[model samples]
Target: MRYHIGDLNPEELLDLYRAMLKPRMIEEKMLVLLRQGKISKWFSGIGQEAISVGVTQALREEEYILPMHRNLGVFTTRNVPLNRLFSQWQGKKSGFTQGRDRSFHFGTQEHRIVGMISHLGPQLGVADGIALADLLRRKRRVTAVFTGEGATSEGDFHEALNVASVWNLPVLFCIENNGYGLSTPTKEQYNCKDLVDRAKGYGMESRIIDGNNILEVYTKVNELCNAMRKRPRPILLEFKTFRMRGHEEASGTKYVPEKLMKKWAKKDPIANYEEFLLEKGILTEAIIDGYKNEISTEINSNLKLAFDEPAIDSNETKELNEVYQKFDYEYFEKSEDVENIRLVDAVSQGLEQSMERYNELIIMGQDIADYGGVFKITEGFTAKFGRSRVRNTPICESAIVSAAMGLSINGMKAVVEMQFADFVSSGFNPIVNYLAKVHYRWGQNADVVIRMPCGAGVGAGPFHSQTNEAWFTKTPGLKVVYPAFPDDAKGLLTTAINEPNPVLVFEHKGLYRSVYGDVPKNYYTIPFGEANLLRSGESLSIVTYGAAVHWALEILDKHPEIDADVLDLRTLQPLDVESVFRTVKKTGKLIIVQEDTLFGGIASDISAMVMENCFEFLDAPVQRVASLETPVPFAKNLEAKYLPKQRFEAALLELYAY
Candidate 1:
C-alpha cells in the first residue's frame, strides 16, 4: 500500500511542510548559539526531523507524546512556545523546568509532552501508564512514545512493550533507528535482524517506514494511530533514519563514516520535502525562501525575548519545600469506635476504604489481582473492583512505577505494591529518579503510593526480607512512611493514598499478621510529620519505627524499670523533628533503633539530628542499635543474629540507666 502528497489537500501539505521545516530552522539557530557559547549543549536532530515532527503532527491535540532530547521536532511541531524552549536551553526561570534542568529534560502537561529521562527507557513505561489511563477513561487517544534504536536494548523497553501488549494499550512506539546508541553501532547494540522484528516477539504489530519521507511518516502514522484508537492496541513503528550530526555538540561526528553522512545529507528530509512540494506545484522557489525567511525571523524574535529572561532565583525556590505540595492535614489517631485487627488486615481495610472512597483509585502489582499478592494483602480485590481497578502487572518494577507516574499525571490515584521491599531495587531508578523527582522538576504531582512489604523475620532470605526503606527516605521529592501499629498503618496508608505526592509506605512483613491493634472501622487519614509517643518516661528517648518499634516495647516490657519515651516515627521523610527534639530534651538521652543495617539506616539520621538539635540537653552521647551489615539470612539463628532486637534491648536498658 502507498500514500503520498496526493492523499492530502493543499493546506495539509503546507502544514506538514511547515511542521518539518520549523524544527530544522530552530535547531540551526540553536547550533549557532551553541557555537557562540550562549547555550551549553544541543543534541542536533538535523536528519531525523521527519520522524519526530511528522508523527507528532499526525496525532490529535489531546494525545500524549513522550519525546527524547533529540526529538526537538516533536516540541516545535506541537507549537510549544519558542521563547520557552530557547529559555529552557538558557536555563531561564521561564523554561518548562524552571531552570531546575535544561534542554528537553522537562515535560509540559499542557502540551501533552512528557519528555524522556537521561536513562532513556523509563519513559517507555510511563507511556504505558498514559495509555492505560486513556483506556480506562474509554478515550479515543493514542499515546505516542519516541525511542532510539539504542534504548531498545534496555529492559524497560521490553517491559513497556510486553505490558502495553498484554493490556492492549493504545500506545504508538515510535522507534527512531538512527543507527547508534550514542557511539555504539546498531550491529553492536542488538542481535535481531531489525528492531521491528523484536516487537513481534512481544506479540505486537509493527512496521518499518522511511523516516526521512515526511509524506510516508505522516500518512502511515496517522493511519496506524487512527486504527489504534478504534482497536486500542499497541503498535511499534520503526522509523529508519540517520543522525546527521554528532550525538551532541560536544561529541564530534568523527566516529560516523563520512560516506554514510554524505549519503544521508542528500536524503535531507526538509530539502527533499521542499522539492517534492515544488514538483507538486504546492510550493514555489519564492515561497520556499519565504518560509525560511519567516522561520528565521520568528527564531530571532523569540531569542531576543528569551535572552532577556532572568535566571532561576535560588532564594525564591526553597528547594526542599518545592519537593512536595503543601496542604494542612490532620493526623488520624485511634478513635473510641475501633476494632482490633492485624497489621496486614489494617492495610487491607485502609486500601479497601480508600478504593471505595476514590472511584479513580487503581491498584497494581505482580500477582496482586487474582493470586491476592504474595502475602495475600489484596486477596479479593479483583473480585470486588474487577481487573481494571485491581491490575496485575508483569514483574517489571521500573515499568510499573513509571506507569503509576503516567496514571497520576492524568489525575488518577495509583497504588503500586511490591511483593517484597527488596524487589524495589529493580524499580529503583523510576521510583527514586523519575517518580520521586517529577514534582520538583516540573509542577506535576505524582499521586502515587508504593506499598513495600519489608523487614526481616519470616526467614524469607535476602531476596525478600530487606529493610530498605532508608534507600528512599534520604532521596528528596519522595515521602517515606513506616507505620508501627495497626492504627498508624491504616491511618498513614490512608494519607499516603490520598496525598498528591510520590509516597513509599513500608509495611513491615514481620508485623503483617503478628501484631494486632485497634483501628478506626471507617475511612480516615493521618498527616505526615507527626510521631506517636507509644510510651512515655523521663529516663531516655527511644526513637524507632516499624518492627523495631515492637522490639523497643518488648525490651521495656521485660525491664519495667527502664523508663523511656518510646517514639514511633510513623512517617520518615516528613520526619517529626519537633517530637524527637522534645522527647530528647526531656530525657536528655537518646537511643535510636532500626531493623536495617547500622551504617546508613534512617535511625542514623535521627540520631545525628538529635545530637545536632538536642546535644546541649543530652546527658550522654546518642546510641544507635541496628542490624549487622549483612543480608537477611534464611536460617533461623542467622536471621536472629542479623536482626537488631538484641542490640536494641541492650541500648534501651543502657540508655535508661544513663
Candidate 2:
C-alpha cells in the first residue's frame, strides 16, 4: 500500500498539524521560563517533533512507548496534561515523578509509557522484554522505543536488536539521526553511512524516512504497527532530521555552522507540514489560528495551576518513600518442617517453591534451561517447570537485566542469574542506572531478583572469581543480600523474591557446595537489616558474611583464646547497625573480615560505622582484614597468597594483644 499524506482524512491531517504545533508552542514557553529562571533546564525538540508526534498519533493507547529526553512531542501527542509536563520541568510535587526526576525521566503506569534513563540505550533491551511479554501472551501490541544516533553506540542497542530479532518481538527501534551526537557530528559518531544498515546483520526490517514530513512518518509507522501485530518482528525506523537548537537550551547552537543551520532551517518539520496542510486545503489560516489559540490558552492555564500547587517539603523528600513492596510475613511462610539440605539444593528448592507459589515468577539465565546452569544449581528445574518459565537467554548480560526490568514493570516477578557475578560489569548500566534507581526516581520498586554467584576460592580465574557486592551496596534503592549458611541462603532467597524491589543475591560459589546445614523445607524469611549471631564471645566482635564467615569461624576454632563473637551480616545495604552496636559495646573490639578486596570493601564501611557508633566502648582501634588489591590469580600458589587468611590471623593476633 502507498503510504503518504494523502492516506489521512481532513480531520486526521488537522489533528497531526495541531499535535506538532502544541509541543512547538510548549517548548517555546519552556525556553521563556528557562530564561526567566523559573525552570532549571530545557531540552527543545524544536525541529525534530514530527516523527515522535506523528508516530505517537499512529499508536493505540494500549501499546507502550519508551521515550528518551528529546521526545517532548510524543507526550503532547499522547495527551499528557500540559500542567504535569510544566510541573515536572519546575520540579513540583505534582509531576509524574513527584519532583524526583526531570526532563524525560518519568513514567506513568496507567499511560504504559516507560521513562528512559539518561543512559537511554538500555531501555531498548527493556522494550524488547516488554514486546517479548506481549508476544508470549499474544497481546498483538507493538512497543516503540526511541533513541538518538549517539545512543546507538551503546552495547545495549546491539543486544536489544539481536534478541528482538531472534525472538521475533514486536518492537519498533526508532532512531532519530539528527546529524550530531552532542557537539560531534554524525561523520565522527559512526563509520556506517546509514544507521539502519546495522539492522541488516540482525536480519530485521529497516526503513528510512524524511522526518520533516509528519504525515509520511505517521503513515509508515502506522503500517508497520499493524504488520508487527500479525507477525512479531523488530523494525528499525531511522528519522533524518536536525536538533535545530543546542543539545540542551544551555548548551547553545555554537557548534553548528551558520551554513548548515540555514540549510536545516528551510526544512523545519512544523513549518513544512503547516505549508503542506495549507496547499492541500485541509486547514485554513483561520482554523489553524483557532486551534493554536485554544491550545495556547490551555497551556497558560495549566502553567498557572502548576505554579499554584504546593512544592514538596524538604523533610518529605529526605527519606526514600516506599523503597520495597509491602507484603505480610504470612504470605512467605511455609508450612513444611525443616530439613537438612545443601546450599545449592536449597537454592533450587526455594526457586521451585517460589515459582509454584506465585505463577507469575520466572527464572532466566545463560544455560539455565536444559543445561541446568553452569553449577547445576537449577538441575531438574526445566523438567519440572518447562522452558517457558525456566528460560535460557543469550550471553548478553545487559539484555537479560533490562529484559527482566521490563517484565517486572509489567506486573511479573523475575529472578535473573548472572552465570558468574564477575560478568555483571557487562550489564552494569541497566542494573545500576535503571533498575536500581527506578523506585527512587519513578516510584515503582522493580520486582526482580538478580542471583549473583560471586567470590573466589574455586579454580575459576579472575573473570569468574571476583566478589563485587560492595559496588551494588553503594547504589540506593537496591537491596544486596549475602548469606553464609544454607538456612540463611534459602530463607534470604525466598524473602528477596517476595519483596517488590530489585535485589542482588550474592551466592558465594565456594560456599554453595562446601557448606551444608538444616534448611527449612517450609518457606520462611530472614528479614533485611537483621544480623545473625553464630557464636558468642566476650573478648572481641568479628563481623563477616558469606564465605568469610566460615573462614572467620575456622580461625576462631584454631585459637580458642581469641574468644570472638561471630556476627553474620545477611543483608549489606540495610546494614544491621543495632546488632553491630550491641556487639561492639559488649566485645569492646571489632574485627571485620571480607573476601572482597581490602580497599573500599564492606569491611571499610562497617569499621567506620563501628567507630562512629560505639567508639567509646572499644578497647582498641577497629581492625579490618580482606584480600589483596590485585586481581584474583589463576595459579593456586598465587591465589592462596592473595587470599585473606594470613592478614586476618595477623589482625586477630593484634586485636588479641590490644
Candidate 3:
C-alpha cells in the first residue's frame, strides 16, 4: 500500500522538508569533519531524520524530552544552537558542557529538554520520574523519551515501563527501530518481531509506524500527544526506520552484507520524504538547493565560532571542583557545653524539628509512619504531621529510593529510611546514578536524606550486621555522616536535611539504645566535616566514630595514665582532616578504629589522610584496629572476635614501655 503525504497545507509540508534537510546537512558535514580527523567520533541520524523530526514536532513545547546520542535531528528541529552542538563534538569550551561531558549529552531547562545520560535505558526511568513530577504539580506536561530497540533489553526499561503503566503516567516511549542494534539484528536479540508487542504486556497503548513516511510519523505522534495531554497515560511508538550510516564515525559497512545494505538503502527515510515533498509540488529544486546552502553556511559559521572560543583555565577547573563539594565545615562548630540526650531521641527530635520548620519535608520507609521506623526514630510523626507528610512505603527498596529521588527533584525535601544500612544494596543504582549525580549532571540540586540503622553489635547476624559506609565514601557527590552522641545526631541530621545534595546518615543500632547526651530543643545544625574531640590528651590519638566512639571513650576512661586524645569523625565523606592533622601533630602517634572489616574500610582513608598531611610529625606508623575480614558469625563468641574492641589498656601498657 502506498502511503500518501496526507491532506496537509503547503506550509506544513515545507516545514517537514526543512526539518529533514537541516539534520541531513549537519550529518553530512560531521562525516567530512570526522574523516579529516577534526572530530574524534560522529554518530549521525542520517536516514532516520524523518522519525525524530516528525515525533518531536508533534510534542508540546512545555513537554519534557530525553534524547539519545543519535538525536541531532530532534535537537536541530527544536532549534538548539548548532554552534554549541559542534563545539561539544570538538571538545571545546564553547560546548554545551564546556568540554566536561561527552558529545550529545546536551540539556536545556529553558526548552524543557532533560539532559541525556550516557548509560542507555536508564533515561526511561528518568522520563517516568519527570512525568510523575508533572502529575504531582498538575502541570499537564507529557514526557517523551527516545531510545533504540537495544535499550529494551536493560532492566531499567522494564522497571520504568511497569511503573509508568501502573501509575498511568504521561510518557511517550519512542523506540527508533533501525533493524539492528549495532551489528546484532532484532531477530538475534528476541523471538518477537514487533517491539510494540512488548509494550502491550504492560497494558500500555502500543503502535508501529512507517518511519520513512514523515506524514504518517507526525500524524500518529500528534494523536498520541493530544490524547496524553487530556487524560495522561503511557504509550509506546516503535518507528521502523533504516540506518544508512554506520553506528559511529569509526564503524564501516564491512560487516553488513551488500544485499541487506542495498535493501535498507532503498527505504532511506530522509531521501523518501524529500522525494515525496518534491512530487507534491510543496518544494522546488531551487528551494531545496537554497535550504542546503543555508544549512551548509550555518554549519561552517558554527565551526569557526567553536575554533575561535577561548581555552579553559586551571581556575575554571578548580571552580568546577568546588561545585561538587557541597558540605560546609564552617556550620559544624562544637558547643562548649554538650547536651545530654539519648541517640534515638536526638535523631527523632532533629527530624521532627526539621519537618516542623520545613513544610516541604516528607519522610517515608518501612514502618516509619506508624511504627516510627524500626528503631522508633520516626515514632508519633504520622499522628502529628498527618499521612501526606509521613508516609509508609511498600517493601520495594528500589522503588522507594527512586521515588524519593523523583520527589526531591520536584522541590520536595525527602527523607528515606532504609530499615537497615545493609539493605541499601537494593537501591544502590538510584542512589548512585539518580540521586547523587543528578545535580552534577544538570546543575539542579536534589536535596534528599537517607537514614539507616548500621553497625554490628546487636547480633543481628550477617545480613543485618554489616556496615556499608565505605561503599559510598568512595563515591563522589555524596555526603556520609555518622554521629556518636545524641546532640551530634540531632545537629548533623538537621544539617543533612538542609543541605542541597544527597546525604547518607548511618545510625548505629547499638548507639540508638545505648548512648545519651544533651541536645537543645531549638533549631540548631551541626557542620558535617568537623571532628569532635571527646577527650584531649597528648600521648596518642585514637580516631573513630559511631559505636566505636563510645568504646574509645570507655577505654580512655578506664586507662587514665595513657593520655589518649579521642577524635570522633561525625561525617565520613568530608572527613575532618584539620582535626586529624592537629591531633597527629601534637600527639605524634595515631590509631584508627572501626567495626567494619579492615579491607577497604573508612579507617584506610583516615590513615591515608594522616600520612599525606602529617607524615613528618608522626613518631611511629599509624595503627588500625578493625574487624576481621570475614562475615559476622551467629555465635556470640565468634561475633565478639569478629568486631573491633577499644584495647586501650593493652595499648597503654605497650606505649609505656616505649
Candidate 4:
C-alpha cells in the first residue's frame, strides 16, 4: 500500500501526537526521579515514542500486547491508568505486581498485555501462542509483541517467528531498531543490514517504516493489522528509530558518538510530530501547549499520589506471595480393579483421562503425535484426541514452553513434553522467569504442565540424563512433581493437569518401561505436599523420591538388619515437610538419598530441614547418599559408579555403626 500522510483523521492524529508526548514526558520525569534516587533505573524512549504509540493506536482495543521495557508509550496508549503506572515505578503496594516487580515488569489479564521480563524475546512465542488461541476460537484479533533489534539474536526470536509463520498466526512482531543494544551498535550486533530482511526466511510479510514519523508507522501498521484480522499471518514490522539516550539512567552515553546523538536530537519524535501538526493547521501552538500542560499536571498529580503510597514491608518481600490455586479432583475416582501397568503407560493413560474429562486440554511435544515421543509416553494420544489436541512441535524447547504458557493464558490446559529433561536448559529462561512467575506477577492462571523425562541411571550421558528437579524446585511459582510408583504417576499427572498453576513433572526415564506395578484403571489425583510411607521401620529415616524410592526399598528388603523408615516425597517444591520431620523424629537418624549430584541437590535441602527441626531427636549425625558431582559419563560402568546403591549401602552401614 502507498504511504499516505492524511490517512488518519485530525482527531486520531491529535490522539497519536498526545500518545507520543505522554511517554516522552513520563520518561523525562523518570530520569529526574532516577537522579533524585527515588526511582532506581530508567529505560528512556525519548526519541522512539512514535513507534510505541503508533503501533498501539493501530490495534483494536481487545488485541493482545506483549511489550518491552522501553515501550512506556504503548502502556499510555493502551489506556493503562497513569496512577497505576506511577505506582509500579514508585514500587508502591498499589502497583500491578503489588511492588514485587518495579518499572515495566507488570501486566494484567484484564488488559490482555503479557508483561516483559528482563529476558525479552521469549515473550514473542508467548504472543504467538495467544494468537494461536485466538485463531482456534475464530476470534478476529491480533497479538503485538515489541522487542529491540538486538533481541533478533536470541533463539526465541527465530523460534517464535517460525512457529507463527508456519501456523499462520495473527501476530505482529514489532522490532524497534534503535541503533544500539545497551552500548553496542547495530553494525556490530548482527551481520545483516536490516533485521526485517530475516522475515523472508520465515515466509512472513515484512515492512520497514520511519519510526520517528508517527503517521507512517500508524498508516502501515493500521493497514497490516486490518488485513491480518481477516486472514491470520505473522508480520515482521521494523521501526527504524533512535533511542536518544543511554540504555538506562546510570548508563551514560559516553560510548555513543556525540555526532549520532546530536543528529537524533534534531529528529526527536515528539518535537517533529508537533512541528508537522502545527504546519498542517491540525494543532495550534496554544492547543499543543494546553495538551502538554494537561499531561504534565496529570503526571505530577499521579506521581504525588504514587509517592505518598506506602512501600511494601520488608517482611512481605522475603518470599514471593505466590498464590497456589487449590484444585478439587472429585471427578477422579480410584478404581478397585488394578492392572499391571508400566510407568510410561500410566502417564499416557492419565493424560488421556484428563483430556477426556477436560476437552480444552491440549498436549504438545516433539515426536509426541504419530511417533508417541522418544520414550513413547504419548503413544496413541494423537489417535485418541486427534492431531489438533495432541500436537507435534519443533525441537525448540523455549518455543514449546512459551507457546504452552500462551495456550494456558488463553484458557487451555496445556500439557507440554520436553523430549529430554536436559534439553530444558535451552528453554530454562521461559520456564523459570516467565511460566513460573506468570500467576505471581499478573494474577493470571498459568495452567501448563511441563513433563520432563529426568534421571541418569540408563547412562544416557550428560545431555540426555540430567535430574533437573532441583533446578525447578529452587525456582518459585512452580510446582514440581516426581512419582516413583505407577499409581502415583497416573494420579500426580492428573493432579498437575487439574491444578491451575504451572507444574513441572519430572518423570524418571529409567523407570518408564523398566518398572511395573498395579495401577488403577479409574482416574485419580495424588495431592501435592503429601508423602507416602513406603516401608514402616525405625532404624533410620530414608527420605527419597522418583527412581531412588524403589532403590531405598530394595536396599531395606535386602538388608532386613538395617531396617529403616522409607518416605517418598512426591512433590518437591511444596515438599511433604510434616511427614519428613515426623519420620525423622521416629527414626532419629536420617539418611537423605537422591539420584541427582551430591552438591546443589534436594538432599541438601532435606538434611538442612532435618537439622533445623529434628536436630535434638537425632541418635547420630544426619547422613546423605547422592550421585557424584561429575557429569554422567557415556560408559555404563563409569555411570553406574556415579549414582547411588553403592553410596547408599555404604552410608547405611556407616550410620548403623554410628
Instruction: Report lDDT per candidate.
Output: 0.89, 0.87, 0.80, 0.86
Error of 1 at 390 (Å): 0.3
Candidate 4: residue pairs that collide: none
- Find the number of clashing residue pairs for candidate 4: 0
Model 1 pairs whose backbones collide: none
Task: Indicate the residue-level lDDT of 22 in model 4.
Answer: 83
- Best TM-score among the predictions, by candidate number: 1
Residue runs of model 2 more than 4 Å from their true location after superposition: 1-3, 316-318, 322-336
Tens digits of per-residue lDDT for model 1, 98-182? 8888788999989999988899889999999999998999999999999999998899999999999999999999999998777
- Give residue 615's error in model 4 in angstroms: 1.7
Residue range 313-349, candidate 4, lDDT tens digits = 5564444445554456445678798899999999988
Clashes of 3: 9
Question: In candidate 2, which residue pairs clash?
Answer: 334-523
How much is 248 displaced in model 3, in angstroms? 1.9
Order of candidates by TM-score, top first?
1, 2, 4, 3
Candidate number of the best lDDT? 1
TM-score of candidate 3 versus the correct structure, residues matched by position: 0.90
Backbone Cα, N, C clashes tallied per candidate: 0, 1, 9, 0
TM-score of 1: 0.98
lDDT of 4 at 355: 92
Candidate 4 TM-score, true structure as reference: 0.95
